[model samples]
Target: MKLRRRAGLFAILAAIILAIAYGFMPKPLPVETAEVKRKYMRVAIEEEGRTRIIDRFIISAPVAGFARRIELDAGDPVSKGEAITELEPLRSNVLDPRSRAEAKARVAAAEASLRAVKENVHAAKASAEFAKKELDRLRQLFKDALVAQEKLDEAETETRRTAAALRSSEFAVEVARHKKAAALTALKYSAAREPEEYAERVIIKAPVSGRVLRINHKSEGVVNRGQPLIEIGDPQALEVEADLLSADAVRISPGTPVLFERWGGDKLLKGRVRVVEPAGFTKISALGVEEQRVLVISDIVSPPGMWAELGDGYRVEASFILWENDNVLQIPASALFRYGDGWAVFVFSNERARMRKVQIGYRNGLSAQILSGLAAGDKVITHPDSSIKEGARVRLRKERTL
Candidate 1:
């Protein structure tokens, strides 16, 4: 019986010791883990972009004239040399009473000038006729040897002078008549301002084959020379313009591959960078942040049919691939943490967290290239908190609740 009592006491003491030890032992930390693997990795800069025509032609008014109402709407197809607009003579500006009186007086004065020129022409004709008669008489007398040769020459010279003076007077009459007519047209234009009143119209034609993009003025109105009238561009020829932050722009150069998305198309449009503009401009973002941006132009390399509907000023999301690798060792970016002037990760091994210093190469926002210290199939803790330390016990986060 004493032996049996001793055995019972020893069993109770063993149970108490085990309970105490269990209480003091460190608990395995619940951690999310990811595996290191090989993947086709790409480092890209993403930003919103816009689609624009490769060559945009802006048709402007060729002269200051009254434009006919634009019959073509935006998106209307146009062929090269097709007449798109007709410009009539500009409507006269509203004339004040004083100006109107002056115009009327000018018209009267031009009429008077024309009448005076006609009288002068008539007088010149009379003088020419009399001089010709005298010359004919002198010629008869000279032929009969009854007049001196010098006298006949003088008569011929007077006849020629009168003939030339008559011609000059006739020319002056025509000029005066033109002046009078111009003054009349100006006076009449104030009352008559219709398309039919204009003698001729200036027809503006499309310089290239394309669709009309914008119509600056649709209604008939006076347009000045060099004023933008319509914008035309070929929709099939598409290019992308992405405004990237200056810092990101420097990392990319010409020939960088680009992918366009969310541009109202089913296929992913592809392109290559054509130019990185040397100049930078200040832009205000939606967040009201002042950002220095550079324009990166890209040519769409895909077939025209893929993005045929895309026209100027269409929005798109552009991904500029700065670097790429066919197959690369990579891990979740969250798995890495700063460690002593380098980088480190807590690798899950044998149910414990093992701190490992690693060399990393390229890093996208979501993933990083593992240059060293990590291998394929290695599991590492991601989002490690302060509780995680070297040699600490850990378990797959799914295995337990927080």
Candidate 2:
């Protein structure tokens, strides 16, 4: 009985030691894993953009006048040469105390200027007449051999100069007369104390057959000549304007393929690079960072029927395909971690995390191209943490497919 009890106690101690050893063993780290892909890989640059008409037309006031109230609004369709608005002559100011004094002073000043110019004209005519008589006398004396040829030439030159001065003075008198007339008219209209009546209005027409995109003035008001009144454009012919970082714009060339999205459309719109503007501008980002940005114009290659909803200044997101290839090895960007000067990933092999150094090529926001040190169908830990180590035992919590 004693021998059997001793053997049972020894067995119990061995069982306890085995249980402790099992408890101390490390458990496999549960992690998310993804497979290396052998499909096509595309690296693109994406930025927010806005849609605009490829050709926009702005109509401005043809003359300085009082613009009539606009009956049309933005988005209203218009035809070429159709009258959009009318401009009437501006009304004279009401004859208030200060305004009446100013008008009277202007009239008096213009009358004085007209008198001065008329006197100058009379004096110039007198001078010209005296020069002509002197020239005739000089010519007669030269013919009688009494005056030198140089004296006769001098007299003729004086006559010609005086004639030109007379003509200039006459023109000045005409200008002064017009000024006086304008001043008198202004004073008379102000003193009439009656509301102005419009006898004629200049009609402004649309230059293009399209919808009005914007209107600078809506109500009747005095407007100057060449003041922009409305903007018109064809919404069907659309182009996208995207501002990209200066560095990225340099790599883009005309004819690059582009994909447009988030333009209130169900499907993506297609476009191609039409131009990369040569100039760059400074723009402030939301994070308060100053960046050099360039405008990249992209023509919508999609048919008009596909993006009919797009209009001028509509918001969109554009992705420029910088590089792409079919049958290239790639992996999820999350599977990568910085290892030395290159990159590394915890490749899942034989139920363990095997540290593998990788050579990376093109990388976008979501995925990266694997140039070397990895193969298709290999599993790598995604979002690996500090708990994960080289040669650590691991188990797949979930499998991610690209």
Candidate 3:
């Protein structure tokens, strides 16, 4: 009876120990994954920049004056030869009265001198004619031997002296006429007239038909010569000015296609590289590093109606298409992994993670072109974690939580 009781107790302890071990056993954790879909991909470099009009004009003050009234503001339409701004004539209350009086007196004096010289010329001409006639009579008398040679000689000398006096009077007349003309010209300058005078209050006109972009002068003020007053540009004609690194600029050529965006538009605008400027300048980046920058001028390929809402100096983003390929198999950049000397990816197969090495082509920030080792409809792990290993059995979750 004792042996039978001991056997029953040992059997109960063993059964209890087996039940506790079963409850402490681990359960398989679920994992999520994705399939690799083949699609066309593009590799692009993005940059932040601003929009600009291809042809911009800076209208400046032709003369210094108080910029009394600016007839237009930014975005105002102006026609060719239109008056955009009016400047008040600079008036000075301190004009010397004696200066005006002296000018008038000089004019009168010049006129009087001219009249006197004319009279002198007339008298001299008459005297010269008389002297010539007297010399002819004396010569005739000498030839006929009716007078002494000495008397003929005296008459000849007197005629010569009168001819010299007449010539002197003629020169004096010419000098006086020139002086009078000069005095009249000076008088005209003193009385400055509108449109004819190159002085203050010069009307600045628009050289071309366009919209006003900037107005530097706000109130009535004086501007020096050659100072900028306003900027103008054609609203219909617009282009983008891109500042590219010098190294990248060398690879870009004219006629290359470009994609533009964020110029106050929801859709991307198309454009072409029109010009690559030969000059380059130094520019400091946001990190305070100095770099050489080159300007590239591009023409908007999109219709004018699309960009009509855009104004001058609007900010825009541009992407230059250095190269492109169509119908190429590609995958997301996250799906790739560096294995040994080549690239590899985790391809889902047989309900487990399979390690497959892949040959990669061109790779951008977003996608990578798969040359081999991957095909369309292959499920690959995008976000791989250390817990996942090669040949590890995985159950495809219905939803991708990551």
Query: Which model scores highest in TM-score?
Result: 1
Worst 10 residues of 2 by lDDT: 186-195
Off by over 4 Å in 3: 1-32, 65-68, 86-90, 93-201, 324-326, 385-388, 393-402
Query: What's the lDDT for all of these models?
Result: 0.91, 0.92, 0.78
> How do the residues 286-336 of candidate 2 rate in per-residue lDDT, one tens digit apiece?
999999999999999988898987788899999999998998899999989
Cα deviation of 207, candidate 1, in Å: 1.0
- Candidate 3, residue 115: how far the Cα is off, in Å: 24
lDDT of 1 by residue, 1-402 (tens): 999999999999999999999999988988988888897999999999988888999889988988988899999999999998899886666668898899899999999999999999999999999999999999999999999999999999999999999999999999998999999876677734553456788999999988998999889888999999999998888889999999999999999999999999888989999999999999998899999999999998998888878878899999999889989999888889999999999999999999999999999998999999999989888989889999999989752111
Provide the lDDT at 374 for model 1.
Answer: 94
Off by over 4 Å in 2: 98-188, 191-200
When 2 and 3 are scored with lDDT, the better candidate is 2
- Best-to-worst ranking by TM-score: 1, 2, 3
Candidate order by decreasing lDDT: 2, 1, 3
Better of 1 and 2 by TM-score: 1
Colliding residue pairs in candidate 2: none
lDDT at residue 137 of model 1 (Cα atoms): 98
Tens-digit per-residue lDDT, 1-402, candidate 3: 999999999999999998999788643334555555666666665566666877789988777666766867888898999987777655333326786677678879988998898898788888878878988898898899988999888778878887888888889988988888876665565534333543545677899998888888756677777788888888678878889999988988999888988777878899898999999999999999999999988888898788878876788898888767877777777878888999888877787788899999888887778888888777777766776778877766653321
Task: Assess every candidate by TM-score.
Answer: 0.78, 0.77, 0.65
